[model samples]
Target chain A: MSFPYSEKVMEYFSHPKNVGEIEDADAVATEGSPACGDMVKLYLKINPETKSIEDIKFKSYGCASNIATASIITELSKNKTIEEAKKLTWKKASETLGGLPPAKVHCAVLAVDALRTAIENYEHKMGLLKEKKSTDTNIIEKRLKRVINPLTGLEVLKVNFVKKIDLDDGIITITVNLDSDHPFANNIREEIVERLEPLWDIKKVYVIFNDENERH
Target chain B: MEKRNVYLDNNATTRTDERVVEHMNHYHLNDYAVASSQFSHTPGIKAKDGIEKARQIIAEKISALNNEIVFTSGSAESNNLALKGIALANRAAKRNRIVVSKIEHFSVLDSAKRLGKEGYDIAFVDVDGEGFIDIDHLKNLVNDETLLVSIIHGNHEIGTVQDLHSISEIVHKKGAYFHTDATYSFLQIPVDVKKYGIDLMTVSSDKIHGPKGVGALYVSEDVIIEKITDGGFQEFNLRGGTENVSGIAGFGKACEIFSEEDVERIKYLRNDLYEQFKSGLKGVQLNGSSDFSRRIPNNLNLSFDYIEGESVVLHLDMRGISVITGSACFSRALQASHILLAMGFSHERAHGSIRFSPSKYTLKEDIDYTVHHVKEVVTKLRKLSPLVEQQ
Candidate 1:
């Protein structure tokens, strides 16, 4: 059966691009999955002044796509700046190789993660976090906030540690902010009551804290 | 952009064959009525006809009577039914011990374990380094309380063939039932149900070029089988629910093809490939029985010692040569292969094991290419190993 891969990717893998090692590599990264008997090692050299990749090579230890993905990543990364290299994703690599089936798609993602992680290691050594940033955190925060506290039926605005009642037992009761005047506050109180039902045996836990303890 | 996929995971699950697909499609399209429907019964009648045809063909292949075969989803279901069904059905008599081999598939092993939870005593028969079961040990393990003797016809990991005839005789002498999960080596070998005296046997379609999610259980006419699934009386009130007509028909077609011409032809190709591999490769050790008669024709399990099976398989996959690793990587599934471990191989050797199973469609050139790549890849991967250096 014909597998999804570009002529270039297939050719490079058949006669793998940079088949062996770089004796004195600028950066070398190895990722291993002991379960699947898959291991991948990447070697790269970057012109630190320009931050553009010079030489990129890899040795892959998994499936056909693993080699193709690793080889493609190296070829694609060569001549690209470190900042540009980190932006490389599995979707783009797979798209570059035509495409991978749903199951083998994980192989491409693994290759990309290995490449970016290798680049990150190099950057950490050089003490450089790329100035480029993503807006994902904003969207993620919004999505995570949707998970309301089932106990108090409230949006957990913040969590502050109340003083421990007993050191040996690791027990503490903290105050949670629920809108007292809200119409559903009675329902929220009932919800808290229901939540604490199983935990009721430890009866000392009450929701009250000093105003000074609410500092961020 | 044009892309082609070469799937090598046939042992895991095969691509449904063209003829089987056609048969199934016909049943699903033209014969869409439920087999149980009282009103609008043409489709129902066709479905029943298709099922009966499947059952008859399956029965003939295994040398079983038509009434002896019960349809199931797959080997897992069939195995569970054979083990648990027999146990539960005979529970009233309070016969509650199961004797099985360690080299049996996870389906059989897990089912046995589940039965243990239900207060059944379970004893395991172990295999040697060559994956052969100790028949004497199996004989010693059987006692009066033993309810069933479950052994696999073949080992899935190391391609080990068990002496089913000997096992059957021993179990029968003890007055306990013998069941074999024949899914691994049934179609590959001549499965003489009478010769082995198998009280219960399970066979799956996908393993032998049929559809997945379809299999059959061979119950001897004399062996009283109790129902497992409690519902409608579809499969003679033994296994309940509406029939998968398409799957059953496809399974029947696969069984027919298996019993006819595919057997000798596939075996020839498999032997040729093995001969080429044995001659071409050095430092390669076959894990199971080296004798062709003692093993499955198409399955070649080997421990490359220095090179990891995952590395070899992955390299082959990249080259569009599909193969399977007998061991699981740490980050992969939890089951790394209990069969290989049970066969006295070290953890390192187990992880270095690979299984090469050729189908009826596997051509000579494909095997040659595989051999060539096996030589090259094993050489390359061994260089990355300290074990090779030490050796």
Candidate 2:
């Protein structure tokens, strides 16, 4: 496949802006995923007065797209406020580059992730950052769902509803439905029984609607 | 940047030389004729002469008799013929057992594994961290039931040379036949069948700049081989099929090139490249032994921590420079190398391994260009790595 790298991407990589070390840099962030086989170490110099980025530099160990993404991100953040750079997403980096291979879209994501991670490090060190955002808050709770577990090779019926998690209460009840002759009814019953025993008191466990169990 | 592309992937396959190309072209265009023609015509005479020249050069390179070297498709075929052919002939069904090393190329390993499933017991001797075979472990494994011992000459990945003489002595002590897959080490490292007491040897042409799809097996004059297939009379009534004449011609030229440069000059270039690369990249760890005396100079396998080999290889590829992750045969698979795993490398570190092999044609400028690009790409990639935390 012909990888058409953007001219600016190549320009920054070949003659990178702020390529070397910053002696008095505000923060340095380094992170790598052993699974992905790439690493990013970001160095930033922020103006103490304006809380804006005076310089940004990065060194990356990965593919062509990864190197290009990092180079462009550093160049884009120079002279920009921390909030502006924090707002820059992977989408912005992808659009800046002509495009990347589907497998390599992660390279752009990593570049932005590294920038945000570095900024987070800077904010935490300065004692100005609040608690980091939790990823689960935006998740919409659905009623119930069934899916296959790729790792365990088992069918699991998952309920997305949140019950009152009463640890002090003696007993807790969870309602689920099995109206038809579901093949994995017994399997799901066993799975749920195995999961709930340790956390909650179960004086009597009963399957209210399991026509599938009776038919089988 | 210069437009000239470098090919250091000779271990994958050597480029067909100009002289060999001319010889093949001349035979195909003007002097082409079937070698099976008994009556000597002008075309037949040229074909016969070409085949003889190839055989003679190959024999001389390995110090074997002219009749001992039988041409086959390649090392895979040669190994199959050597191991299976010997086992089927001498070993009883219940007594079938083959001894091999863990670091052997798949041509030997898979061939043994296939036979093992057919009620043949297979014993794989392990290698140390430096890619050296544990002779004592091999000795403990070999017994009277052992049909053959197949050890590779030089490791294709780490480039550590095996002590064939010692290994051959151990197998013979146990009254078992010895075989060495000298595919990667034939021309680069010295080999002597008489000195090592090798009963059977397998080698390929492409590893030494010859045409692909042509190889030879050195079966001892006294050793017996069972026919693996039935066909017309070819390869001394053992492997029966029409021979590849052009590939054989190319193979001969490649052997002659090796004989001409018997003391290889590429070792110095390889060392220079190794030193330059080692000093340029900080936090780089050499995979095998640092002793040049024990390893092949042309092959430098290194691990750059916190970076995946595939990514490093891609960065180098983008710069128009070529290298390898390990053996080219297993390049497509993104798993830890089995050899490295057997030698006790964790999966994470093993996946980060890369091999740098240079041929006689690789220049100083090539190494310089590689070092420059490697530093840049590694520094950049390290930033993105979550495992390699900023200190």
Candidate 3:
């Protein structure tokens, strides 16, 4: 079978750079999870004086695209200042790897999410950022933004699948515009729940699909 | 000669045997007339003879009557025809309930699903951890209302060979027709329809080193089934289309050339490869039945801890090895093997599972090379895996 991976993707997958842990890393963060089919952990050694990333490494438990995307994300962010690294979007990492298949675009998103989380962790460690309340809607929205609609290679929120998000009594109810019988509804629902269920305050996560007639 | 590519994905499709190809060439070039024109001309009679000879060869392999065989495109079409045909034909009998094992191939499972959409009651029986059909669960599912039960004879992914005699007994006790997709275990495992009490069976050519685009469905003479496709009076008027004469001839030749010795050798190679992996690698677990007698000889599925399967498959591909994985990332649907999941394996186990099926053409040297490279690849990938603990 023909794999849709680009030449650059195959190159990075074959010989990924910075593939290990920084034992004395200033910050470390993991995004995605084993249950989600892909997980990436990023380690950052930040230069305290310059606020720049001194070294970066990654370890991945995922497919070729996942490894390749993480490799490129590290390559794009190394030695850059924290503010500059924050601007390193998943699209840029994907472009540097010649672009990923639509189904694999989430791997790029996951890599960028891990890198940004590491940066945020470093900033938090340095007392530069305040600890936001865990139950904030902003946190919910940000997590949902990483929940990709596999069919469109876009976030559920951006695709307008999230018709409504209700948080009450520690239970989060997400209403998606997709029909219950839609081919990808179950997958999207599972991903949404996986994204939200791990919250520090979430007691239960419920994903409701809008009726097919009301989908439009 | 130095070996270049090592192919261990024989369960998917084998390299068409050279002898089978030569046998097919004679029918394609010399006896090119339509088999349906047997009543009108000499070439037509020759074509008809070729078709009948092939039917006899395939039928004899399974110990079924020559007239019971209906040729189709492949296992998928055979399965579709068997499930839909039996269900539709038996509608008047008020037997609207159809049962199938959870681990059946997509063709059978999806056809049952379509039947479900059409208002037929479909029940999926579960399988055990080693991929054996849950006999007790199957007994509970089949009853007077059940029309047919379709289960896979040899699982394609994990290599579990079901006890056909026992499964058939259970289905028949409840007056349901038994059908099995025997694509993987056709000649490698002995199947006697009469002895096993099977009413229908699906067999494919490509899996047995025959030409692609050819397979046969074995229907018992007493079993009534309707044609799903509308066409001319072909395939006992149960399936309609111009016959694939050359492909059928090749399929027959492939069956005729089946050797028990080759199966034994392939089994040995498969076991040897597994033994090498067991000794050479760490964190390796066999996915299917440990007993060789209970599994297809050529198939070996192993799950490596801490690393995902697609990464291992891709790395092997680079080293001229061909294999397949049960990982969601490897499939178009982005779903892990339902069979593995149904067997109660964790998603991690399914994602890490890789299947290696050696054919008669596989050599000991190739297995050695594969094991050597697999060790290196798994070691490298393990190092890069976050799941693996840092030393």
> Which candidate comes out best when scored by DockQ?
3
Residue B288 alpha-carbon offset, candidate 2, angstroms: 2.8
Q: Residue by residue across A1-216, what tens digits does model 1's lDDT show?
A: 664455755665555665456667666655443234444567778787998988887776554566677778887888999889989988898888877656567778777866775676576456575553322324223322322332222243333222222211222233445444433233333323222321212232233333335312
| lDDT, candidate 3, B1-391, per-residue tens | 3446999999999999999999899988898888865567888888888889999999998899999999999999999999999988877888889999999999999999999998899999999999998989999999999999999999999999999999998898888899999999999999999999999999999999999999999999989899998888899998888888999989999999989999999999999999999998989999988888989988999999878888999999988999999998999999888998899887778888999999999999998889888999999999998777667
Q: On DockQ, who's better, 1 or 2?
A: 2
Ranking by TM-score: 3, 2, 1
In lDDT terms, which candidate is top? 3
For model 1, fnat equals 0.20
* Candidate 3 residue spans exceeding 4 A from truth: A1-3, A130-216, B1-3
Position B257, candidate 1: lDDT: 68
CA-RMSD of model 1: 16.5
Instruction: For candidate 1, write residues B126-183 as lDDT tens digits.
Output: 7777878887788789988888999988766666678888888889887999999888
Fraction of true contacts retained by every candidate, in order, equals 0.20, 0.31, 0.64
User: Chain B alone, TM-score of each model?
Assistant: 0.93, 0.94, 0.98
Score candidate 3 by TM-score against the native: 0.87
lDDT of 3: 0.87
Task: Record all residue pairs in model 3 with backbone atoms less than 3 Å apart, i.e. clashing.
Answer: none
